[model samples]
Target: MSEVLVVRGEMQPWTDHTARQPVLAALLADVIPANRRTLILGPHSPLLIESVLAHSADVTILVRSVSDAEQLTETFGPCLHVVAGALDGLKRAAAVQPTLFEVATDGVQPFEVVVAADGLDRVLGYDSEHLSWTERLAAVRSLATPDAVVVLGLRNEFSMLNLLDRRPAHLRHGDDEWVPLHDDPTRPVSVDQFQAALPWPAQLYADFSAHTLVGVEAAATARPGHLPTRLAVAALESVDTPLLTSTTEPLESAARAGLLPAVPTSWLAVCNAPTPHTLYTHSGPTTLKATATETGWETTVGVVTPDLLGTVGYDSTVVPARVPGGESVETVLFRLAAAEDVPGFRKLAAALGEWAEDSRVLLRWDDVIVAGDTFAFGISGWVAPESVDKDDLLAAAWLRFHRRLVDGHRRHPWPPWMIGDELVSTWLSMSGVTLVDPTPATAPHVESAYAEQLAWGKQLAAALSVVLDSPEQTHPDLRTQLADADRARLELTELQGHVFGLERTLGFRNKAMKTRENRIRELRGQLQKATTANNKIHSSRCYALARRLAQFRNPRKVAAKARRILRQNLNKLRPAS
Candidate 1:
């Protein structure tokens, strides 16, 4: 059973809601003193507490929430002592009631190890007296023995993540931030300030996230494909927080200006510990810790299992911890491409081709580290399921690299129009692999690796299309211009379809008007012919006589004239008969 101490008059309505960070916990575990009395301040991940317990049997955890303290006691059992109280209340209780404070501390003695990795923000209770950043640090230090090991973490207000965050400060504020002291002037914002604030010498680490930590010197001197640069870039790229813009460009600019270490998301300071030169990161399920040595890099994996390879359909292979003595091929290739050195690229391709032909190992540009003329796999943990052809493997590797280049918006020396399989084929031909055509449809029959690579590329492309299409300005590379041209062409096609529909409608209307005009012309012609015939009939002599006889003044005169005409006609008819 664990010991639980609850301070009277402690804050009752406050609860800490901070999240657990595994990477930070791992780092803390590396520096925590072994077999010494340790005190953990504020809320922390259960993983960290477990690690601390493993190192030291006697551990004390102080939290403002009574519920949190009870939960810690339940989880840790007798190995942990939980104190539910604010800092001020603990201080007063120690002075007024020595027995109660002794129960919380296990004795009236100072701690040999003090860990405030969660920072000082969450230590104060709502009803307790407020303390500034420096005051909080002093309070934590006062509880530790004269030669105690102290591990501290501080959040940087001007970090790139905070600067790029789109949410307003008030909107991002949490319920526990009733008396937020993030803006305290005494708070350290840089490595120098943090070191200066501490009484003992401290080693600083630039904490990009829970999964990545780079030494201050390593980050300051990072370059294109150096391990530190790789880790930093990977960390920034994997961030899930919604930001006002992509951090890719900003990170590159920072690296170029040698300001990367100065603007990390957070800083970790370790006192009474050896200077740490190792870089630690968690890539997916694999935890990679690399340290630079005289010969080369000495890398170690925390967990070595088949699960590290994800879904590549390959058997488990244990990779060596030591890296080859050379620079990564990716770094050299990026340099060549950026300079637009076509001849140099071709020469390197030929050399890589020869190496691949000789050594039947799979070659990924980033995985292949080169020293002089020697090429070898750097840090990888998977093998092909079966024997794959050299041509297929080379083609797959180049095609994947091409996809990365396009996705990253990287520049190359190839023609602006040369893209997709065509450009890939060109590179392969230079590498002594002959492929007349390499389209997705024919990829399966020609090379199974090619088809598989294409499928993976399509899926990744869909996922990254949004980021690639962001409105941020980048180098106007061929891929970017091609994407823009494709959009323009699509718009043009729609406009042409709309114009064609309008033309068809106008043509139909013109045809209908022509038909109506022809009908009207024919009707007019018939009416003109009838009028001519009527005129001719009126001009005839018989018609004129009938008209004159009918116009007589009286009906009697008309009848007498009709009888005389009838008698004349009857006499003439009789003679004719």
Candidate 2:
């Protein structure tokens, strides 16, 4: 028997984003390499598949598993008996139409238009069991030639969460004795199953840009001709999926060995090809572990990768509902307090209950949080900082926050919330600050708080900074201090001038008094001698007069020396008044 064509299902868009991000389309444009034959298995978004098929015709497209007999019986009836249930479907289909599955579009697909739907499903990943599904898929693809690009298309059901198996909304066991796996009880209808119904002339396409990989040209005729003109299988890897050519050294492609997504026999046909168990063991969800280390505590949640399930690790966990004190867990947060409220800054702690909400409009970011006097929050999300150019949207968000805060503060007088700046919030914070450490205990709380704080803090900090740094008060304290210093200096200058003048005047007066006595004594001797007593008797009298003058004139040399000393000393003092 030729290889049986077993596919999961297909998706078609009634709306837009679905086609824009069609699984196969992305794989074709991205992960799937050029010129390779691949069998895309899974129920598909019909519109999405068609869009992928747009103007491209090289690869093969597998529609459904041979085992889905029920879906077939309900839709097509006994005509497709061999391919009824998911199991039988794969077995019989592969027998007849195996080789003609689909063709690769030479990696070239041209499209007229591509548009996004308003409401997009959350990117795939989910349920603890999904880990096995991912692993199986990877293992199956490994069987294909390493040089050949293998594309695995996931439905929205295989959500981002599916990568780990967070309990699917609904989980069940599909009968596959050969495989020990279960269906997601929560959502049996996966993204792949969600197909774009092409009624009559209506059709849906998946190319987001101007190009297309696979397009479905369908019309209600005698039978469904899934034989795509060019069966193109686009590959999908996580956005970060490494290129196969990235140096063929130990290119350890990771797979969630645990997720047991139901695969068609076509996939099982190649499962053994990758040497399934030789390289890395297929993984399954192991239970979370709670262990103690020297560093206080540690706990892991739901699923941990690269480790065998049930492997022990250290971390903390917020007890779920039935646990006491857990009910109050409104949120996890990194609290940024005002300078004054440094210690036990609990406003954010308190705000957790407020921010933890079920709406997407809310800021849902938290991943890591460094806790201390204040907290730092972070998340694991990609942001195209350069691509963001919506100033108005930023402004609008800010306005909404402020308006909300105002209403909240009025409604309930609690933590006085404040709004932050718009520009920062819009451009800078859209690419956020990552939390240093994240814990499951803080997941709900942190996620909400991170979102709220970034949105709030960016706006608040920007606005406050601008206002405080305004020309009016940027240098208030320095300007005031400078003005005071200038005034004090001027007063000191006036006082110095007055003090110098008084000192000079007092010194001059003392010198004048001291010299007066010397002058009188010198003149006295001259006056008493008069004319040496006009004659002979006077000449005798002149001697007595000369005797009196002799006391003051005894040391003319000393007197001259004293006068010189006085002048020099006075000159050393400040100028005389």
Candidate 3:
């Protein structure tokens, strides 16, 4: 059996067991049409193949090792077009040297779709001399049709994950030069930068750690408004993302519209040339419908109208009102506004501006405007613009996203204990961030420390037991004190059980009292109704007589009827005599 190729201390032939695969596949299924010829670089995942096959597309998998190719051929049979060779060699033959492709079994034909499922990382590590990001991307493009869709799975560097995981080290294989890999381009390019990098226009979908590709112009201004609620909540709760609140803008218009700021670790990029299509994006052609006011600009998004800048609850009761966008970008500058952290807001805005366009930073008084309270300060909302997959890819992506949330929560537990921090507590409420795990850190040292403490505790308890039991080590008074303590502990345990029983009995009695009280109230109501009827009867003389008659009529008629019957019987008896 051929051993799997290892890179950077990880197996290259297989994909990580992540939820991203299904999500990416689902996204791909949505974008790529069935019956299209697809070129898959790096069969890093069986899920990638399954996603491609789901659409019944013409599939081709290119692997670097001969053993991998042979194994794939056996596993998938003749249906799979498995090719073995280095990407650099293929690039040299097809592009650099103008030679025929070794894997061109049925002759080279332009592929309608090309997927870098293994991502640039694996592709970069395929040979001794890794390919540059631009060259690798260009080489992948060469296998595509004129207007074929190009999908790239990218990692986001700005994610909260990077802050915790600092494990990147690049070194030359032969030379001892310790430098970052050529493939290690500053990741997570903006939508504009990403488009500029590509020969064709493209859109980006990013989370905290990952992104996906889609065609340009596919990103609608309103796309962020319609994400899944769970997905939206994840984004909103993300402390790493500044404009996660932008998702709530669409919620005002429609409840079913999806939520945002997914913080997913993987990204998907779609390049459209042959067929232009729409894809979801965070930032798109957002038109700021704002009207200039005496103090500042009044903004409107979705159904929320006349959003007065630097004001709290000015339009609290107001419905949709008219507002117009000025030619200039809206920037609500604040100076000495009550309770407004102008400096902090500016700092945060500067940080966020790195990822967004037309970066207008504003400070508004946050917190509810109480009847008497005069001051409030915080961030209310922020907007961001930006820009998935086949079915198996989508399923994998969904699974990955879910796992990320679950595992992420497991990693960095929510701060329920940090309720004292108003900002953090409030952010938790507004954002969809929830408690995944309550345990502390999950790192090796953290776990090891816990284990050590537990062992120490057990040892301490055993030592205490031994010391207490050993007559040689213990004083007579100490032994007597220990016996007394044991007796007290037993007494306390018995008292606790007795108290528990009493508490249950008290609860039952309380319920019975409540039941009696309700019954008494019902009877009182009935008595009140009867008294009212009696008063009504007494108020009218005729009604009183009719009511009395109703009460006595039946007895009086029965007595009168019995006397008449007796008289008739006496008359008949006399005649018979």
Estimate every model's Cα lDDT from 0 to 1: 0.71, 0.29, 0.42
The best candidate in terms of TM-score: 1
Total backbone collisions, model 2: 125
Report the C-alpha lDDT of model 2 over 1-577, residue by residue, as the tens digit.
2232333221221111222333233333323333343433333344444443443334333332333323323543322222212212332344455444221235322211121121111211121123344344332333334343333322333322233322333442222122333353322233123231111122222221112122211101101101111011111211222122211111111111211122110111111112111000001122222222232123333333332111121111221111111101111211122233423324443333233322211121222132343222221111111222233223333343344333222232224332333322332233232232323445543443335435533443244323212233222233234556786887789878878888898889879977997898988888778656555564586777776667675488868888999999989896757
Q: Rank the candidates by TM-score, best first.
A: 1, 3, 2
Better of 1 and 3 by lDDT: 1
lDDT of 3 at 563: 99
The residue ranges of model 1 lying beyond 4 angstroms of the native Cα positions read: 1-3, 8-15, 18-20, 93-109, 176-178, 275-277, 294-296, 308-310, 313-318, 324-327, 357-363, 382-389, 413-418, 436-577
TM-score of each candidate?
0.73, 0.25, 0.37
Alpha carbon lDDT at 397, candidate 2: 31
Q: For model 1, how does the per-residue alpha-carbon lDDT over 1-577 read when each residue is reduced to its tens digit?
A: 7667876434565567766566766666678768988888888889888878889757888888888888888888877878888766666656655553353444345578888887777777767776888988887877876678888888888787777766788866577756667778898878888889997778888888665888887788765565666567667656666566656667767877888888778888888877544677764345666776766577776664543222233222445577754567877887799899989989998888887852223456766777677777765544443445667667757766786687676788888667776677678778877654444555444643234434533433333332222343433333346777897999899999999999999999999999999999999999999999989999999899889877887989779988999999989889553
What would the per-residue lDDT of candidate 3 be over residues 1-577, giving only the tens digit for each residue? Answer: 3222222212235332323344355456666778887777754556667777777556776665555566767777756666565455544434432322333545454577887745555443334455566766766776666677787765444333332222332311222112233345643344445556777555555432222222222222223212222223333333232221222223322222311222334455667822222222221112112233332224333233433332111222221233221111111111111225545434433332222222111221111111121211111222111101111111221222222323222222234342222222222222222312335666754542223322322332233223212223122223335656897999999999999999999999999999999999999999999999988878998987776668775787868988999999988889553
**All-Cα superposition RMSD per candidate:** 11.4, 27.2, 25.3
What's the lDDT for residue 60 in model 2? Answer: 37
Supply the TM-score for candidate 1: 0.73
Q: Give the lDDT ranking, best first.
A: 1, 3, 2
Which regions of candidate 2 fall more than 4 Å away from where they truly are? 1-24, 63-143, 153-397, 402-577
User: How does candidate 3 fare on TM-score?
Assistant: 0.37
